[model samples]
Target: MPDCQHGLIADETETDDESIIGDEAHIVARSDDGPRGVSDLTPEDRDKYDNLVLLCRKHHKIVDDQPGFYTVEKLKEIKALHEAWVKESLHLDKEKEKDDLNYASYIDTIAKTFDFDSWDGWTSSLVSHGQPSIRYKKLKELQTIPNFIVSRFWPKRYEELEASIFNLKNVLNDLIKVFYKYADEGAIDKAKETDEDRTIRTRKFYKIDEWNPELYNKLSEKFDYHVSLVEDLALEMTRAANLVIEKIRKYISPKYREEEGKLLMTSGPHMDFSWKTFKVEYKTDEKKENHPYHGLKSFMTERAGRDLHYGEGVDTHYLPKRFEP
Candidate 1:
């Protein structure tokens, strides 16, 4: 198939020929009665790399049409021979190989900083009170990861990883900012009559102390809005982090196992909040007509246009949906 002069793209403007089309022809046909049909393999196993061979379109058709001649064993032997030949004949760039190894190491470092093993345990606090319980030391490490990402040069092949990293950084920064805005620090209260002073230090959302009903409602709504935003950002950050892990697994290490399932972090199956939806509903409510934050809707709408460049070089499809609008 490598010797076959089919599926090559001729570009008059460019000196080099484009990539050749190598169709993934199955050794054992996916379904019975097609090509080298077999009933023993599962649907998942049928599509596995071991059961597949890369061949030119013409050879793919020929092998499928004459399955008797190109049996599973025969195809596998041919594949093995071709691979051996490629290994011997093709000369890989040593510098590029070193770069790839370095890049893989860099990605591993980033993954470690994320601490995927303790992700669920720490992120569980997000939904409980819209604030993460990550230790200050871990928080500092997480904070520097964004800077680490932007300071390095990412390979073009792993653009998906790059985009996912940026999305995660954006969401993480937003969550941290929102947390700082509402997060109350530890405080101490001294009793007038008692000898001992009580130390009251709890991590909770700030509460408004206004007595006026209308003003209180307005402030309360604003506080609720921020809490919702924090939760939403936390969720987005989880998704983005998972996506980074996925891309790392795909492009760098096939054996890499981080999270058990597709989702690395989740706050359980509860009511999922969307800041965008909350903003829309808040704007439509007639009772909150004079809310000061109503004017901020226009600013939120411009997020996509303002931050679209973050996904530049990578497929924007990998970005979180929050950046869409």
Candidate 2:
């Protein structure tokens, strides 16, 4: 977008009568029923219409979407020639760009195009009025209008205030940050509690309760209503700050340690060991000479000692299952 120039110009609704004519310029028809193409026009006419090169919507879209086909240099050249031709034909003086035309009306057109009505269901909207405060005032007025058909068009007006509200919000946030800094630096003192100003003074820490308390209180006494939104906000902020501090101290450290351990176990080597012992006892039911398997135990134990290398006096098992083999 081009930078806008200040001051009011002609209203957008006003139309100029000087027309571009053939031979020198031509209009490209957008559809089968629209204006004809440049090739059909004359080559020598002084008419300003000779300056227009009409393109169908598709071609225009292409030209805008991929400008390399008719590069920026060529586009600028064409625009300059066209504008010059129109200026000469209409005897119009070169004028600075108008802010009302460039910014406000353009914004209005976009808002109307989308048919967005009412702030009730919309998260975001755009406003295009000149003064930020006036736009906001209009938006607030919409809330008072009844929801019947008479006020059905309020959403469009409300949308036009959205940008204004955004701008104002930015201003407010900056002011709040300034006040907080002032409070932190001891540049501004916390207001003391009084019979009537008790809560109002306390809210200085949180809300836009008062920009100038003396003025605010005088107005409030006359109006007979609380204007201590700022003070209430300050109190809430103090509570929130305490909550955040407590949460950080109680939970943040141990949580970090647990996460660190999990990170190490998956990515590093660690050992797990177990310790237990198995004991075996041996017994004979019959005498060795009377039994067929008498020497089997002795033979097996001797073989086991030679092959397995058990410690001396370590009892040996012959029956595999019974002796804990």
Candidate 3:
């Protein structure tokens, strides 16, 4: 039988007539003497594909000899299961091919939006103490990346990649918001006036016009905290980006290489930043506890203070330990 324990296949080239005679067993037998012959099925219906099951001679005789053991329902179930297995085996390759194309498309979209080739130049402004350095046009382009990422239909197999992409998006959005808040518009315009290249326009963090000792201390602390947060987010974003790149290389394309500096913003060996030494957790409800990018809204809106902690855990501890003059 198709689901026989012996796992035998009928060879049409065999010379034995008895071997092939009952090879095509019927669930509701065609004649009264045959197996499961008590059914009221019509002659044509008994010979139909639904009623027939392909089996070896041994199982055919066994089933026919003891029709009570292998009933019409049992044979029908066996036939259905066997056919399902065959169908899945035949289509496996086609499904894999389709998934490969989808993976390529998704990875390509991420890589293009990241614009890794110009990363170093665009991020060079951060070397000057986390200033609003990204070009206006470039920042605008970067802002659209999250939309593209969320719009894609990701497969279950790339869950980790999807997660990394979302994390990067969250950090990037925070950085952009911070830039917009503290950016010195006047400084940017003045810089554009001095520079011949219009593309060289850059923005800096706005400084306090008149410094009262107490006000200066408060604003300075907030400014420093914001700068630290920006730097930390940038590093976190880079880490997430590298994770996505690695996954793409491992799963989608082996030939893909990580871009130079891995899209990390670095001033020098001494100015490098990392999140490993400090613990940072975003606020989220129980349902979203497992999500890596949770509580992004709260993280952005939280007021900077002396403690620098937000939510349940210590969320922002990576303040730059610079020496005061």
C-alpha TM-scores of all predictions? 0.49, 0.14, 0.54
Which tens-of-lDDT digit does each residue in 202-257 have in candidate 3?
A: 23323467756777777666666556555555544555566566666767777676
How high is the lDDT of residue 162 in model 2? 32
Residue pairs of candidate 1 with colliding backbone atoms: none
Candidate number with the higher TM-score (2 or 3): 3
Clash count, candidate 1:
0
Clashing residue pairs in candidate 3, if any?
none
Best by TM-score: 3
Candidate with top lDDT is: 3
User: Rank by TM-score, descending?
Assistant: 3, 1, 2
Model 3, position 246: C-alpha lDDT score: 60
Q: Root-mean-square deviation of each candidate, in angstroms?
A: 18.5, 35.5, 9.5
Q: Which digits, one per residue and each the tens of the lDDT, describe model 1 over residues 1-325? A: 5467665343444666555457888999998888878669998999999998877778989999998899888988998998897786554555567667877877778868877766766565555443334444455567788788778777665565666666667667656755655454442123222423332222443445656777767665555555555555555566557666666677777666743644434454345552211111111232122211211233233222321111112222223556455
Q: How many clashing pairs does model 2 include?
A: 23
| Candidate 2: regions farther than 4 A off | 1-98, 105-170, 175-325
What TM-score does candidate 1 reach?
0.49
